[model samples]
Target: MSARDLVHPLVLLRRFASDMGAAIRVGGVRGGLLATCLLAVGSLTPAYLPQSSPYWVPARALGLDSWWAKALGTGMVIAAVGLLMIAWFNVRPTIYVGVKHWAVLLWWSLPLLLAPPIFSHDAYSYAAQGWLVHNGLNPYEASPSFLPGPFADQVAWVWRYTSAPYGPLALQISHGLVELAGLNPYYSAVLHRIPALVGVALVVHFLPRIAILMNVDPRGVAWFSTINPLLVIDFVGGAHNDALMVGLVVAALYTAYRGRMFWALVLIGVGTAIKQPAILAAYPIAVIGSGWAGWHVRHLARFVVRLAYAFAVSIGVFCAISVATGLGFGWLNAVTVPGMIVTMAPFSLIGFGVQNLVNLITGDPNGQLIWKIAQTLGLVLSAAFVVWYAITRSRTRPVSFLAWAYLAFASFGPALHPWYLTWGGLLLPLSKPSPRVWRIAAALVSVLLVYDAGNMAWRNDLVGLALAAVAAAVIVLYRRYLRGHRPLAGLGYHDEEGEANA
Candidate 1:
């Protein structure tokens, strides 16, 4: 190769860096950039690091276990969430046109690229599962605890004995990453995040295209979906495979919306091979394929055909991956593993409460029947809602239908995590929701961020929790003061043109 050939790539790299730098210098992007940087630094504290992790040793050595480190890290992360929310609301399609918005995402994501899993230890389970697969074991049948090694030690205790409930493709990918990491537990956990980043990248690339097709503001969609704190904390920071699944579902939805039914179904199939919940995406795809003109019976045949095609394609992909990975069908039986824990899910909570009440009244404290009944009832109700919405509302707003369906699944399922909400929350912006809907969504996001951060601190260190509360209180009071005084520019409450739009 000539010297000019070698220098050509370098020139392009430098030019790209310069352009991104100029973009970041804009005041509109600074808040989010600074927030992500803060999040990255805060994540290095001992609280965020897995206790059994090799990564935690170094953090402890750095005196990050001190009260100040704990409190400050907690505060920084909470403050980062607040700032990111503010920055997200301020993002206007008129102002952050095109790649400028992407530039902001790049800056925000860069800091979290290598951080330890935040808010969850599920990534460690990923490492152990990959280790099992690498050792010629079926993760669907064997818990991580079977081996009793470094990898197994890193998984959360509650899940260490639970068989893998993830799809075969995810296990295969995990095996490859674990093998690539030389079986080192920490690196395996960190390397698992690569798939998540790929998923996030796919969403960043396709969500805007989908939005544009639906006549929504592409920039707004990008900002809402990509900069979502839930995405950052759960998918990227916690390294959840749902990122890959959601990314593929978004791409499939885009293709289906664009009239490529076969390809859309294929993408949905592949996505289902990563996580079963992704199959829910096919309902919307089928609706889009039907070319709905009205509630008339004319589209019924097309819808059924499309739905059947989706089912066939998804089942084929699922079985193909199962056979290819030699992990046949065991995951189907293991799918209920997450339900072992009673979470804040609407039905789970009700069941627990009812069980307690019945036990108190009947003097049978060991009773389990009531809880099981409530859980089953919740699943049935959630399923009924999904079917009702798919039939009644999906024809007009297919994407929104899918979003609400996923939300129903989360709320009424056996367990609900903050990240579960993102499955639907990410799609709301693309549906052209009303201003009130945006307000509600934003408020939920803010509340969840604070709760998760506070909960983490409460679990790990009470002192940190108190300090974090103080920090949050200060921010809340300051925001009130700002509202009373001069308007905060770029926050949508006061735009450049002096409109109080928010």
Candidate 2:
């Protein structure tokens, strides 16, 4: 967008280390040391990914099936989490916005970007979608199985015949990468990941800025989300496009905070093109932009009109991208495709227990029917909650309503995935979540890291165990620190009225 923006991210990132707060400077050093440990863990993960990447070791050296390799992986994962715990919460509240945290994030995340896809082969699937676009096929209607090549082979088997669930804008990015590779699918899968690095840079840059504006310590807040192990491994290591979506959404939030409502809407629309989770951001932003904090018939009408205008502009952007790429709106149904998954979210878990209970009593099994009914009910309730919150009056900081509402959706909605957690997890920092929120988020991270159910389920569990260990360490250290010091007074506070609402 500007010559300054075109400056290399590395040079820019290094500059961020300057002018560190006293607390931040001290904690940042610890964060840097911990980041080195994570770097080693991420470097080793490529060998264990579903499909080997360019940096993968030979079978003899990195056999995922071998007991010793499994043990080594368990140890590495535990060590990674433990070190992260010590850096993030064990010490005093440190401001972590400087060079130390940025370097740590870069050191840990950079290598994985060039390594093989980790956690999921969604990158390969994205490449296949791009291949469809390159070959003049509609990605929404066409499946990766339509193309037979090394790229298609890299996609997971179950998804080979499935149309892309991601937005068409995402298709354009992937397609452009493959096109740049001269239509070579193999290179496309790897090249498509380059954009995610840019996304990381955006997160690295904007999150600190957002924290500062919110009157919080940018150092720890930024470190907690930006250098987080889950974000690092999934985004950089797995090359998931979720990174792109989050970067756009976060920047959009920053824009809205700065009072550029129109640009915020535009960013939200563009981010939706990356993933559907971002689409949810539109509601809260629209509500805030409407400026109807009071109840009146005219106020209600004004709110609706403003909301429609925002959607018109955002949807107009989406339509333009679809038309330009010739990738029609088949993605409309893609978001609903998750209805088939019996997710492990709290609402779904309750339904699952109820379904199992009914089956035992009736001596007949109707798990599917009951589960679907419960899932639908849960989704309805979650959506209602979101709408209620979106329209509610916030004294200041519109992110308050949006952050809490979106988090409720993620926690209770039917669709669940570890990466999906980042949708609200990243924004939590912007909203100034309470200590309880941080504890909940920490626990969820540990669980999500190991929640895979089939195929590599056991291997996932070991990694999960490591994260659980790390979670335990965090609780212990947090309590230990609580003994010596009073509760943290945030970096700064707002006016009494602002604080009440914030």
Those runs of model 2 whose alpha carbons end farther than 4 Å from true positions after fitting are: 1-47, 51-57, 60-65, 90-92, 96-101, 181-187, 212-220, 287-293, 350-367, 394-397, 450-457, 460-488, 491-502
User: How well is each residue in 330-367 modelled by candidate 2, as lDDT tens digits?
Assistant: 88766666555556677677778888898998887755
Candidate 2 weakest ten by summed lDDT: 493-502
Candidate 2: Cα lDDT at 11: 59
Best by lDDT: 1
Error of 1 at 342 (Å): 3.5
Per-candidate TM equals 0.88, 0.80
Number of backbone clashes in candidate 2:
6
Candidate 2 TM-score over all chains jointly: 0.80
Predicted candidate 1 versus true structure: per-residue lDDT over 38-128, tens digit per residue: 8878876656776677756776788878877877887777677777666655544423543465567777677777877877778889999
